[model samples]
Target chain A: MSGIRVENLVKVWGAFRALDDVSFETGDSEFVALLGPSGCGKSTTLRLIAGLEFATSGRISIAGRDVTGLASSKRNLSMVFQSYALFPHMTVAGNIVFGLSVRGVSKAEQRERLARVVDLLGLSQLLDRRPSELSGGQQQRVALGRALIAETPVCLLDEPLSNLDAQLRSEMRNEIRSLQQRLGIAMVFVTHDQTEAMSMADRIILMRAGKVEQSGLPHEFYERPATTFAARFIGTPPMNVLDLAPGADGLVIEGGAGPAVLPAGSIPLQLGLRPEQVTFASAGQPAVVETTEYFGADTITACRIGRQRLMVRAPGRPGLKAGDAVHLAWETSVQHFFHKESGLRCEIDPAAPAKKTRVAETTPQ
Target chain B: MKASRNALYGGLLLLPAAVLLWTFTYQPIVTTFIDSLYSTPRGRRPAAFIGFDQYETMFADPVFWKAMLNNFIYAFATIPLSMAMALAMALLVNSKLRGQAAVRMAYFTPTILPMVAVANIWLFFYAPDYGLVDRVLQLFGLGGQNFLGQPDTALAALIVITIWKEAGFFMIFYLAALQQISPTLMEAASLEGASFWQTLRRVTIPLLMPTTLFISVNAVIGAFRLVDHIVVMTKGAPDNATTLLLFYIYQVGFGYWDTGYAAALTMVLLVILAVIALVQFGYVDKRIHYR
Candidate 1:
């Protein structure tokens, strides 16, 4: 209640629903990320919270006050935009103090806040120059400085580092996360990049088709995804999901691979395994290596297990190349099972025995 | 040898433009400066160099001074008025209003219409008794006044017409600049607790400075070059009240055959334009952000 909350938020544009029945709440000093692919209503949700867009039907409250009908100016929040949005004609100091000046803050107070933000952001020397004269990274810092100077209870960020290069993006990601922690203000950041969401946010709200698919901590999403979409979206190489048929003792691969021991069930299920979980072991399911990608410290080998493609991460170079035969294996405890009809993850029964047999007859050379 | 041949080829490519420019533009400017030092030739008399005499006569002419004053007033009045109206029009059309394309077309129609034709139409509007303007005034229960026939309102009426004709053309440029602005910037401003007017002042106007500078330069040049409306409507009438510098130059050079004095007046106009161009590019451009 002391942070930002949205209840039953729905935004419709004519026939298309941009956000539908979205509800979430951030605790005090929480950093929540709205994570989704493009066109999934993540940005729309942020805009609604920022009051930049009016929700078709919803209620938004900031710091225990209902601001649903209020204009953006009355919302008492600051935002950093993807474009940086620095005023081109204004000096860095001018841009940073613009909101304070607009709010009729005293000149000395404005100067004090500006000085603090300028020093915090390392923009003291650049304060006299206009935004156009600064590099992209510097401009991004100025944008952050502007938002930080507002010192509002809530801050919104719409993919602020998207315009920067990859190197700067990571650097700014850490910087923004540290700054958010130091300020201890509730921030809702919207980004399509899962890494940005996972590395920076205290909580990640993954959205799909204008609906919240899953909301949890980064490791929770990585370990126990709520749905297949969440499973595939959170990781770098993504989770490999293989369809399996219900068998007598366990679930057998729908294709040529042997049975995998999961909890006893009759319904067909999709098995999800992360690239790191699947390993190049001595014996298990038969698989043929298709290709391998080297990432210096690790290598991910793309292999075909029965007809499904699975990526197996191996330490350093596995020395495996395309067209090579190999065996893929993983611990049954680390496997995720999803219902085939609905893509939602299925929980394992705790009473079931953990014993699982490795059928060497199905193992590849 | 090869570099010399390449230079020769480049010179050949530039020859046509260089020749055309020298013949039409450079030659006339040089001839005008030369003629300004000599007195106009009369019938059965040859022209003679008089060493600043033509300039002296031009400086002494009261009508020339009046025309200079009128041009300055015209430029000062029209440029900012047209640019402001253009910015307003651009903002209106840029919104998500119904029939915006049609509205934009209607606003831009005046820009495409010939000034001579537009002035003819405005002449009827400014006519003394039964014009459209007088009809509107009568509907308001006020008596009809001579808009163009009086010295007080003549130049002002011309300035109004120039603003109307030029605002829409400049609106196109402003609209382009407005469209180029990232919509996210506006959203970001709103989230920063900026009001609509504050956002317009801090973000929209500042971002549009380059376009404004470009349009202002054109407006300044047009303010001096454009006299077709004057020719068709006022003909510098009402005791030379609406006589702009270019119109006076035309009247002297062609109507009175005072070519030498006309050349001197042309030099003054050129100097004014040069000064404006220099101030704009050298000073204003340094302040505006191009991107």
Candidate 2:
């Protein structure tokens, strides 16, 4: 197995910078996900690593050798594309054996690997069927099988599960992660979906606007996002931010609302709260429910308070109506603070214990 | 209610076009079929109908059989070779290389030139002493053979020119098909350690089969219908090597002033073309695996 190292990689297409001095590394056998929104350089970074796109500057090393200018075929890596890209005329067995044949593996070894892949992917019955004759999920398995049969040291997946439906996406995501673990190959996955990265990656590199927002373990990023974009981008119902000015006690929540205290001498303050972090209570700033969505296990309530609207993800059976009024509260430990201008997180306060605070998680409809 | 009325009005607007098609297109085909059985002259009305006489006479004509054989050879020679050249050209133009626009324009320029103009240019190029072919052959100390003047080489020369003329046109279809293939597929193939030829054979060619079938069908039909170049360059050759079915029909119709026999030959050409089209569809239909 081989690890990959990308150092200050830059890619420029005329005046536009698709990737700007992006740098990161993946340990051997680690599953790292490059997670970001559209136009965020996540895919560009994957291409650079795969040698599909040439970086204008900097070096990329695989297994301690610089492969920056090598062709993708010489990179000792395998990739699965989002389109599945199964050969339309080739049978499932043919597709699986293609990579091995290209590498000049003997027929016996090719058959052995092919049999293993077919058995692992449950593709034995469909080996004779062409790509068009198979279902979308079945074709996806064939694409995966083709990549896996090569047994390359590094695997790159560019949104492999994006084309699959919701249920299949989750199923395939688990299957892919398990396969990577079992094989002990370093894998780099690129996706716009944060949930996929969070659930599957050993390390997640959150990127935005051709730059790295933050890079760390999933739990660490969830608890302490180094930047505002990371906190907002990594979570569903994203982090609710409220700008505040330095006040005498701590920091002002709104203009005249209670002081949501920060550590003393904290500069450029902004408050961050997740939707689930905020609790609805009776005695607080009243918010009228704008909408309520029932999701069987849990109900999400969208409510408006004063001039702000926010989504609240709470426990089972939210007994709230569209016109009902409620209050919002949160634990102090759950709140995140950041610098207003730079969007970087405020200094950590190790001495402060977990404390409760009252804030309205609502926005005007 | 208003939407339903608008839909009805939209369909009613096409009725005129439908009626025009029925009168102009459908009427001619049916009238031609009826006229193929009779010995009608140009100025005659209510001519005497001689059932199957013209057809029997057409079947026995040596010229008609020769034209039929020539047409088959012309189609068989042109379709596969031109399609292969077209596929190669499409692949070259599809690459991310410098000056791609200039290269594509140069390759596609032949397709846009009129057939008559191309034939005129090739005529001088095939001229005995001062022609491009002779000049090049003389440079290599080789004997300059008369290309368009000999019965043995006339059809082959035409076949070569026909391939040259039609390859670029078929390339347009292959280029479109190549563009439709996702770039991600090639990247995936490369990352799987596939060499250039392996990727082309395994990934690109299989996906391009549908476009190949469609282009071949059109190329075969083009080979049959287009004898304009032969008329300009060889005019049925040093003896009769370049006399295609359509050209033979022109000879019988205009040269000998035999419209009855020409109509019978026309029916034969139509039947042959129809069979070729049906065979193409049958072959393609069995193998088309669209994904």
Candidate 3:
């Protein structure tokens, strides 16, 4: 009630629903990231909260006040656009003070806010320069300055750092995080980059196809994903999903050489293993290394098991080469199982152990 | 030798254009300047050199001063009015409204129609009593007045027609510019708590400054160059009230057959256009951001 709350928000464009009954709430001073790929309704959710777009049927309130039917200007929120959207004709100071000036704030008050924001953003030397004259990083800072100077209850950012280069993006990400903390304002950051979300947001709302797949802390998303979609989306290398079918002995790896078993009543389970959970053991399911990518500290090796591919992350290169024979092994504790049809994560009983049958000796064809 | 050959090839490629430019454009401009220094020849008599004589006569002619004054007023009034109307029309059509294509085509119809034809259509509208305008005024129990008959109203009526003919053409350019602006900017402005007028004043208008400057230059040139409506509608009637510089030049050169005096008047028109171009490009252009 003290921060931003959106309930049952729906945005329909003709027949396609951009957002479907989306509900979320942010605490005061909470930084929430609407994380999703393109067309996942992340930006649309931000826009609806900013009041730039109307919800088909829902309620949006900020600071205990209902603003579902309010115009964007009256909503009393600020937004930083991906394009930085600084007025091309206005100087850095002009862009930052534009909102105050237009709201008919007293001249003395405008100058006071302007000086505070300029100093906060370190924009003293660049105040007189127009947007065109400023560099990309400077423009991004000015965009931040514009939003921060308003000192509104909530601030919405639509992929604000997406236009910057990698170095500047990380730098601004930290700046924005610290600024949000210093001001203790509720902020909703929308981004497709998991790293940006994980590094910046206190809460991550993972959306897929206009619906929330999962919403929790960043580590909660990585450790205990609610769904298979969440598991694959939250990690960098992504979780590997291998299909399994019932066999005479146990649940056999569908396209690979392995004799594995699922719990009773498991409906054609798919085994989910993260790359770091996989290792090159002395004996396990047989796979042939197909490719190896080195990234200074660690190496990710792509191994072919019959027709299915599995990625194994090994620290310090592991001296692996393509065409080498390897056996993949992972602890049952780290393994995640999901029903192949519904794609929902299946709960495995802690007392039961994953049964492994005969190790089939199959050579790469 | 290779460089020389390349230079020769470039010159050869430019030869036809240079020849045509000299033959048609440069030659006429130089000839006009030379001819302006002399008095036109009479029947069975040779022309005589009278340096500045045509200029002296032009300065003394009250009709010439009237034409100059009328041209300035026409430019000053029509340029800003048409541009503002164009921006409004562009904004209206740019939005996703019903029948938007039809509305855009309707606004642009006057630009494609010949000026003579448009003037003829306006002629009926301004025709003293039974005209469309008078009929509309009659609805208010007001009698129809001669719109194009009196000297005061004639120029004003012509000015209105020019604005109608020109605003739509300028709208096309403004529409193109307005479409190029990212829609996210509007969303960002609204989220920043900017009102509609404030966004237009701060974001839309400043971004459109380059386009406005481009349209203004064209409007200035067209102001001095266009006189087809004057020739068709008033023909400088009601005591030369609506006679523009170009129309007076046509009268002096073709009707009175005073080529020397007409050339002098043409030089004045050319100088005015040149000054406008210089002022726009040298001064105003620096303030406009290309993007």
Question: Candidate 3 on A71-184: residue-level lDDT in tens?
Answer: 888888888988888877788888898888888889999899989988888999998898888899999899999999999878889898888999988899999999999988
User: How many backbone clashes does every candidate have?
Assistant: 0, 6, 0
Candidate that would win on DockQ: 3
Evaluation by TM-score, superior candidate among 1 and 3? 3
**Between 1 and 3, whose DockQ is larger?**
3
Error of 3 at A158 (Å): 1.1
- Tell me how far the alpha carbon of residue B208 in candidate 2 is from the true structure, in angstroms, after superposition: 2.3
TM-score, cand. 1 vs. native? 0.93
- Top TM-score hit: 3
Q: Give a tens-digit lDDT track for model 1, residues B1-291.
A: 999999999999999999999999889999999999888999988789999988888889999999999999999999999999999999999999899999999999999999999999999998867998888888888747899999999999999999999999999999999999989778767776778798898889988999999999999999999999999998999999999999999999999999989999998999899999999999999978545
Q: Rank the candidates by DockQ, best first.
A: 3, 1, 2
lDDT of 2 by residue, A258-337 (tens): 43355345466777878887778654435678998888877788877545666788989878898887766666568788
Candidate 2: docking tier: medium
Q: Ranking under lDDT, best-scoring first? A: 1, 3, 2
- Please report how far candidate 1 places residue A132 from its true position, in Å: 2.3
TM-score of chain B of 2: 0.91
Q: Per-residue lDDT for A69 in model 2?
A: 96
lDDT of 3: 0.87
